[model samples]
Target chain A: MNPKVSHPRIKEFEVVTNPKIIKLLLDGTRKDIVFNYLVNEPMTVKQLSDAMKKKPGTVLHHVQKLKNAGIIQLVETRETPRGIVERYYRAVAREFRLGISERMSAYDDDTVASKDRVRAALLGLSTLGIHISESDFEHAHDLLQRLIDREAEVAKVYDSPSNHAFQSLPPSTRYDVSYRMSQFLLSQDALYRKTLSDWHDLISHYLRKIESEMV
Target chain B: MSWPSNYPDPEDNDRKPAETSAAAPSPSGILKDFKVGFTLAVKNFLSFGLAMLGIILITILLLLLIVLFILIPILFTLGLPFLIQLVETIATGFQTTTGLTLVMLIMFLVLPILGPFFVALGAIFGMARELVESDGTQAESAFSWYGKRGLSLLGGGAIHFLITLAPLVIAFLAISYPTWNPPSDEELRVIIPLIVVWIILVNGMLSLTYPGIIDGLSAVKAAGRSVRLACQFPVRVLGAWLIITVLVTIPLIPVINEVAFLWAPIIPSDLLEPYGALAILTLLFVIVPAVSIVLTRIYMILTAKVDATYTQGADST
Candidate 1:
């Protein structure tokens, strides 16, 4: 044992630079498979199918596609009844980075406005043990869209000015300074601030609602 | 990476894999831990800080009571003279020879009772973990394990405390070596620095000892795991340990009142008696909780990658 290197764990992140892999991940079923099921821990086809309410055959097909793309890997296998073996698979990384492009629009219609992103967010919230009612979900979706639009408006106003100043800086300094400037500008933006406040209020209100129901 | 020939089977879900493909440690991750730790500390300052203050005061009272419990009987047997001597010693301050004996008695005799308090401090880490990883935690959660797991944590605390004290005792012994043939100046210089480094390194290695106990390991097992973690991520663990050590030690700086390091002590020395009760208060209120949160945060991050058994194991408590 080297004794210096830490424990055996899957890589933390994988950058999807290859266009083909990006396209493969764009498919809703495969994206769902990676994000909802396989991202954190290994799961068998039977478990995945049961969780997603899909047939094992269909889920296995998507899992195979993901496995072939090198986005997920078979990590373990277990014996089942009748001498059958079930393979457990997990994402090759805990997180996937869209490294090829600044925007995921290359693979989808729209990245932020897309329902897929909201669904993915909800799935993430569910993993955190948060499940909201259908009506609450709709309200959340609307509030999120408003926040997105306000953020876009704020960016449209500041991006050009920030980019022009960033261009004048030395390349090495630009990478570090631009992030700081963007954070500062966002912190000072009123519309963005109000939108964030509204978002916070909505989330906290839901949390309180959940707490009340539990009580 | 190919598995080592002697590696245990990966199919054994009970044990973590002994593979080497790990997430490389980065400064940003440690900084994030710092930011989270400080932020949580600031957010929960009143609740957690007061609780910690209460614990410290209670521990001090318990120690004094225990000392007196032992003292009154001996004093009664010796009659009024010893009582007068104790009062004189206290009035003259602990610098007096008789007072030093009392101090030594408080320090050594109360050692057994000191372990559970460190385990009690583990409660701060517990609350911090809950706030970060799950739903928000209440201040009262700090005492949740007090009555139930008191004995086990006392055992864990004793082992941890002994490991922590061993280096200090060794250093003291080395420095106070027999004077028959005292060591030369050069040898003393090398030995002193080595002892300091050894203390720091030993502490860094055992940084996660309490967290391991909090995660349900026995004290011995926790100490062993902490050493393994230190060996595995020597740089990260030591970096975190040093950062935390420096932060906690800041208020204890001798010149805080003098402000001697500054070109001019712009803030008046009397403004708040710069390093008197204010320093102790800051140490108790701000620094201790912040250090706990930071240590717990780093422990969680490192353990998540290294140990599969860390399903936030202490949550069940």
Candidate 2:
């Protein structure tokens, strides 16, 4: 039986534009509800609570949050034998593109500190069946930090008005040029490329070593 | 691959209406709170301040009358010399055990009476909430809740006061026991951290209690709802609490009182008085009202989740 046939309202993909919605979806249980249980089939809060091994009250709270964010929607309601009305919820979209907003791209240190960046990288790597030891992970994370620091330095140079060749341009135009140039340099420039390659080598070496040990 | 323009079926009876206006509290929301609070404060400063001032004066008068009523009997029963001797013994710690017991008894008697006033502090939140929602609060609205609704708020305030004073009461009882021995350095190490955790957790849980009561919940239900919200959004609740604490403490900074006098040696002495008065006025009219407004908004955002979940939860159960 195809579960998706039962819920025709679920979209194939959704681009999450709201930062608050994105942050809420990042929570493990909420992420599970949208990406796992609701994606499989529409479930009442009681069913979700049983499947997730959480209290009905807790599951209901998360459901409320997701519903409020427009990531989930109530598809129907059923009256139980006891005359209780149970709400059945389904994911609004089967997949979400957690896009970075302009505000989020500004890189507030407090929002995405170095440690959180490292943790996120580790989580990303884990999805690829690459498991590095704690010691090796820490070592590779330092290389990653160096790569970030070098990119930041390159960006700082572009940001300085005196260092720009477009200094004759108006301030707004110069700013636009500097921003695009910095982004281009961070992606393609040798100054940033060297740091990236070093980090890549360190991470891949650990991966290869770990795979060999497993074999 | 594509969604229908009419995604939600309009005829669906169980379909929950979207609450676009209800915002959940977040760390990011804390930054915007101050600006919102300040705007509301500036708009309704005179009315709110006068209302607050009236509450304080009335509370003081009532407390004074109560104190006199209680004191007259004491003075009549225990002569002046005996009353003086009792004060000296308590102040000097001469009769240490007796004095400690007497002090504890007095606190037990006084704390309950003070509960209504503490809950009365919540009237500020209620008024600020009205101003935030543009409900057009009047100065007389402050004194309007002195009836049954006031009692419910008093119940909430009593709950909050009792929770805060629980640790003190426990410590006093433990030490007063005949077999009790004072904790050593090692015990102190563990005990102090535990006390700090208790304070933080309790503060976060009870932060929304009064706001919940003001929203038409019973004192106990409001407290339970507060606990649920705090448990779910611990970081947001604690962060807002920390912000409110900092705002309230700004007036107490010694620099505000001392800075003008410190520079008085360089500048003329005549300018210092106006500076002091200006500082006091800013603290009274600006910071105080803004803090109240910010706290009310934070409470609203945090409990907005409760409204959606619990109301739905009620139906399912």
Candidate 3:
């Protein structure tokens, strides 16, 4: 009578932490590339291999490790040669949280690894910001800002009588407006990230110049 | 609690699954069903337009108020160095999760209650619109479905929330217990089992609750029906969800990084200037709600279709 008893597969999804499980996830290089690519979004193994410049067989090995870890999952698949399938992988969690601060705690002085991670994070952040900032500036900043403000204001009015006016507009129109806003935000973000990256580089250059003078 | 006798008897040797009168709809019949559904949705939309607008407006205002309430504590706690540092890091890493949780809480808990009230109002206006479209004699005022059906709708929403949350509440308790006092290895041993239990409970709850809520059935009755339907056709429900998730996730791949960057401001930043700060705030206010609404609509459409199919089967029986 119990639902759990009735559905055994549901019970099989335990947190797999074993090294063997990790090995299983990274078994093939193709799978590994696919899993890494999916840390951003779901990607077909072909897309993964193409991006990584690796053979499909190689990529599949690593993807299996990610799958076993419950870190990457099959989002979907498409048919290919001889009815072979190509599955898309997506990371299970969107965000990662470290329980303790790695920087503050004592650990191996892997400065190179740390530096690489920091650089990647910074670059990622800067690229995203620059894109958004550019989009924001493209449409006269004031005009776009006003439109956003108006939408916000309209969104605020919640009296009983105005519901008719709200409903009269097609749902698609609302969706269209929202979609445009998201696209705009995305562009602005890209721009912002780029700008930040430039600023960081400039700051670093200046700091180096100051250090040279001090030396 | 037993399977309904009216269920198509698979064991009957004489009758093939395909031979049943209602086993599968003809293409024309499918088209007709679609047409009817579209009409109903349109009617519902039109009649409830004003009420829905009001509900949305109120809901948004309430959300802003809730956000303010949540933020005030953080601002006050910022005076404490430890708390401030913790908040800063969480803000950076968990921006999307925080935003999503806030949005989900508002949508699932608040919207459902307000939604049916508006729907009833819409149904009344929709009937009036139909009469007008037909060139029938117009009455000064139409019968209000809200006045007649408000209680049932509100009751259904209440039941929906409670039934849906039961599993989540249990999962939360299970997950949080270990965190209060760090678990020993023996206690950690139980973690996998607990997680598995939690996933099954959560998924099963979601699969069942949406249909039950839409149908305005009591939680027990809805849950019972859902369990029966899910067990009868496990692959169909799971496959439907899996396919939907994959399809939805595909379009999101290119944009995920962009979305995260846009949302990053909800976390505190020492490096960003006043202008940069303002831009982030503006982005959050404008974009977050829009994205949430679009996603919610997609979910409704998918779940509603699934519910409608079951309703059709029930009607045939």
Candidate 2, B-chain TM: 0.70
What is the lDDT, from 0 to 100, of the residue A141 in candidate 2? 67
TM-scores of the candidates in the order shown: 0.47, 0.46, 0.27
lDDT of model 1 at residue B251? 64
What are the DockQ scores of the candidates, in order? Answer: 0.01, 0.01, 0.01
Rank candidates, lDDT, best first.
Answer: 2, 1, 3
Model 1, residue A118: C-alpha shift (Å): 51
lDDT of 3 by residue, B164-273 (tens): 55555555555555453445789767865675555554454344433333223444564565555445434433433343344444444333434643543443345335
* Per-model i-RMS: 18.4, 16.0, 23.5
How many Å off is the CA of A150 in candidate 2?
A: 97
**Model 3: runs farther than 4 Å from truth?**
A1-215, B1-54, B58-216, B244-317
Question: For candidate 1, lDDT tens digit of each residue in B1-317?
Answer: 88578867567454434323234556655665676667777787877876786666766876677778877896879877888887686667654433334445555655666764765776666565444433245566566645434555666666655665666555554544442244689987887778668767787888777666655566678778888887876666788889887886666565452453444554555764645577788777777777766666656555654633232211110
Q: Residue B45 of model 3: what lDDT?
A: 44
